[model samples]
Target: MEVTYLCPHCIGAINALDNIILSAKTEKNKHGLILLHEEIWNYSVIQTSSINAELGEIVDFFCPVCHASLNTEKGDHYAGYIRMDASGQESKIVISREYGDRRTFKITGEDIESYGESARKYMYPEWFL
Candidate 1:
């Protein structure tokens, strides 16, 4: 199954692989000032240089297109939402601390129960077992 990430703000595609998001990290430039550097899969590292080697703390992942915070809640350690589509089946998998650390799988189009099961199996195998 293929996955795609969309910017919640602009609804723009962010990465190519649709798996594993490399968030921006702060680094110091030659002037010793902090700057945000992001590296996307199959894409060149943004603002990476010899002088900017010190990796700083990353608060949250942002939408590369609109620069919107991906996390649904403030101060969430890690959050992710998955949009799945197969054989005319559409579903959304949202996992976030704001939702009480639960995985919400919403399926639409056809076979709601069956599609939800399949999505859960493909997305989180451990949940089934």
Candidate 2:
């Protein structure tokens, strides 16, 4: 299956991959201070990177096109929507989380019954049903 990461604010495509999105972190020096750096990797190329104020700090994702934050006032974690297309099926998936761990998923599309079901089966939150 193919997955596409988008800017929920501007509905701009961030990265499209044949596989799932991957993330990694490393410490880097910035402005003479060492900071925790995290990056989103797409096909082994760094797509986006950010420096955190401290370790385990939750950084917000921004739209590359409009520079709008992907998270809302609800929490410090990611709470954005993503567009997925597979086998001629197109759908928008809403990803929401309170913080730390809990997350909610909502799917909408012309064929939500089948596309959403497929997403629930392949992705996390099997309770999406």
Cα lDDT of model 1 by residue, 32-54, tens digit: 21122111112222332433433
Q: Stretches of candidate 2 above 4 Å error?
A: 16-55, 88-129
lDDT of each: 0.36, 0.38
Residue 50 lDDT, candidate 1, scale 0-100:
30
User: Would you estimate the TM-scores of all the predictions?
Assistant: 0.39, 0.42
Model 2, residue 73: distance off in Å is 3.7
lDDT of 1 at 79: 38
Name model 1 segments beyond 4 Å from true.
18-22, 25-59, 74-76, 88-90, 93-129
lDDT of 1 at 25: 29
Worst 10 residues of 1 by lDDT: 32-41
| Residue pairs in clash, model 2 | none
Q: Distance (Å) between predicted and true CA of 45, model 1?
A: 15
